[model samples]
Target: MEHSHGAHRADDIEDARIKDLTERFRQTLSTKRMNELVSRSVSRASSPAPRDFGTPQPPPSVSDAQLPTYSSLRNIPLVPQAPQDARSLRFKNMLHSLSNMPIRWENPGLLDEALRVVPLEQIYNEAEEESQILQAEAESLGAGKKAAWGYQDCVVRALLRWFKRSFFTWVNNPACSRCYSPTIGVGMAAPLPDEQARGANQVELYKCSVEQCGAYERYPRYNDAFVLLQTRRGRCGEWANCFSMLCRAVGSRVRWVWNAEDHVWTEVYSVHRKRWVHVDACEEAWDKPRLYTEGWGKKLSYCIAFSADGAMDVTRRYVRNVSKHAVERNRAPEAVLLHIMDEIRAMRRSNMSKQDKFRLEGEDMRENRELRSCVISSIAHEVSKLSVEDIMNGRSSRSRADPDTQKALEGRTSGNSEWIRARGEGGRGQPNPQDPRNRQR
Candidate 1:
């Protein structure tokens, strides 16, 4: 009975403290507003308050840029609610598995050795020329204005061109080492002595297609970037791994980005831009994050970029058209992802100075805002593109946009522009068939 009385006394004291705070808050309001608030408080004290559904729309006087500043505290979600259903557990498991890929590139010695094979002279020369062109354009625009791409960005861009065109080969199937004929898939084999030494945990065995010589060939899937230098060809995995290592060699901080849909890419930190710039060595692409979704019509659920320092769910940078390109994000709840990111960040930054941590936190906040802005920009672009009929009818009437959507948006209209006089599209002679000039001609 004594303990229960003490607990009641404690509750009374807490209520008194809360009332004091509320009284002080009420005193700060204007006289007219305070009167109104008092009347509403009295009314609410008598009756239960009604629930609110939609948040208030911004007033007409407020501009789009000012919306963030004007956002009310009430707009923030306070309760910790589940973002997605339990169906997303599978996606979460896959991301955990994929996280291992980027961890492999942390070896400093291996990255340095990967540098030896890169054609430095050619890459540097190309970067210099491109930098000059960008500088000239910037000069023409105005004084003190920066060029679009920095020297380091141009360096990576040049390296990308050389890496994709001159160095890396896309391996769809292993060709016969003995007869130079196409090979048929024979099945998986245990790694040979040399292969295991060179970091190939798994080896694929292939047999020559020609009946005259049934020679079995070993195609080792080398994970080491240094080993990749000798082999010089692979799918998206090898391309991102080797190229990211080369970027690190050139003194740029790099991240190996893994996509949920079995794709991989790279993101290089640009000191000049104060942000991460997307680079894909396989496609010879630089700073085109929307390439997969907009250009290739690929749907993506997660695009996690992992570095030696940390990891991030950088899905927003790539999947701009959420309605179209967004896959089911349910692999785990958003809170779980947040916890994982925080854990990784704490582990990575544990030894860092307070000042350095503050700076990185600021960068993270800025990047978060930038990602949110991208969603807004994409929505605005889509709204602008919507036809009058679509708005009126509340449905789309026009045909779907082309798979090669970046051509119109990025001014990179032709994929054939890659330095190869190949048998098919992006050819020099044929203008984009979509172009009116080509149709008229």
Candidate 2:
């Protein structure tokens, strides 16, 4: 019985060793067996570590599906940005989107149709050329062209071009010639002699149409046509209308006036000279009484009541004396002197400054209107009292007469000695002899 127990224990130990040895052989022969054993042993000891999805995912790598791949945009040439000027910062916003902006027609909903029909480049080029031509023509006419016809032609052409598109839309009636003629006299048209019309004789070219036509007591009547040629003879209103009509007809500008003490007149803009010319045709038609002495010589007065440019009003008495030639030629002291006085009087009325008023008052007092009106009965009284030398020399009179007035009478005389002196010196100076400033200086 003892021998049998020892044999059983030895066999049991031997069997366990055999089982362990068999498991090791199995592991060496196959990976599945090794894994099963490892799994069973780890499970019995501790659970195997589990994989976690909570671990942060790495950033995605570039791939066909994730990346923006380009075949064309990458190859396009980049436009260089323009260097900005500091001073041009104001225009930055205007230019910022210019490159990216698509062309847009100014009229809404027009782009689709305009792009199809209009040649933008051709239209632009043509417009530029036309503007150039207009500029060139305007440049050709500089400041101060003395010729009236030249001024009229240029003004008319400009008007035609400026209003070309509006021509058919509106029309103005052509004015009658007689309605525009300058004459306050009431008389039939008695055409002047061919010689007088042509200004042939040394006699004054301007004579009252009524007088020249030998219309006794009938006087002269103004029509539009006569006013243009004789701007100082028409009725005040007629003269103004005629002058304004002529100027506006050819696209020049003019202003008309009818004040209480004065007759009608116009101020026409002279484009070439950049100044206005006064026109008072009504004043020119009065009869000028002729006066002559064998020794003193023939003295004529051109009775131009007002300057075409609105500078002064020639007195009615003086206007009846001179010939048209005397006026156009700048002859006749009485006419010029009276005109200066008229301007001075106007200045006196318009001056607002007390100092200016006081100065003008002193000048006005010297005219001796009160004393002369009491003493002098006739037109000749004032003129005859003035010595020929005084008239010619523009000599200042102290007998209650203004020296400034005297100087004005001498139209463009040595009183403006500096102008002549400057001319002699050949300086680029032009002193306006008519300017009161030149006289004051």
Model 2 misplaced stretches (Cα beyond 4 Å): 1-134, 138-240, 245-267, 277-310, 313-324, 327-441
lDDT of 1 by residue, 113-163 (tens): 767788889889999999999999999999998999899988988888888
Best by TM-score: 1
TM-score of 1: 0.70
Q: How many residue pairs clash per model?
A: 4, 49
Q: How do the residues 1-441 of candidate 2 rate in per-residue lDDT, one tens digit apiece? A: 999999999999999887865665443334433344445445546776334212232223322354233434322322222224443332222222221111111223333332333343443454455555655666678754234323343443333232222211111111223333222323233435543453222211122234334322222233333322343332334334443444454345554432222233444444454433444332221111111101112222222222222223223222222332122433223323343445434543573567766754553354235324323443344455677778789984324442222311222111134433432311112221222111100
RMSD of each: 15.2, 43.7
Let me know the TM-score candidate 2 reaches against the reference structure.
0.20
